[model samples]
Target: MKTKLFFFIFSLFFFLKSNAQCAMCRAVLENEEGQSAAKGINDGIIYLMSIPYILVFGLGFFVYWKYFRKKKVEA
Candidate 1:
């Protein structure tokens, strides 16, 4: 249990910080005269990237509620 917990915690840190853009995207965005476009692209990338994580979290919560969290019977 300790090993699994430690591994999860250790792995979590690696994923916490990420540079999501590819080299071409970064280069093009950086060269743009207007900073708003660059900022918008970054925002869009982050928004699109978060959907998978959100979906997985929702699925995990659903599974826990359905199977692990049992309801009490009323007499």
Candidate 2:
């Protein structure tokens, strides 16, 4: 069933791609619309992608400073 659905969509994509005439038809068929909300959504995607790396590195620094440093005495 899953394979059938995948093949169906794959064939549809190739059929449409092969038949695309120009930018307008491609955009229409692909359902891409020019919208301000799309820019906001794109920004949201970038923020989500960056946040995990920032968090992991930030926590790594915090742990290293808080727990890994040796105590020193005046000599």
Estimate the TM-score of every prediction: 0.65, 0.42
Error of 1 at 11 (Å): 8.8
What candidate 2 gets wrong by more than 4 Å, as runs, is 1-34, 71-75
For residues 18-47, write the lDDT of model 2, one tens digit per residue. Answer: 432345544554565665544455555555
Give the range of the ten consecutive residues with the poorest summed lDDT in model 2. Answer: 16-25
Give the per-residue lDDT of model 1 (tens digit) for 1-75: 999889977966765555667789999988889778877777778779878987998998898787654553321
TM-score of 2: 0.42
In the order shown, the candidates' Cα RMSDs to the true structure are: 3.9, 15.2
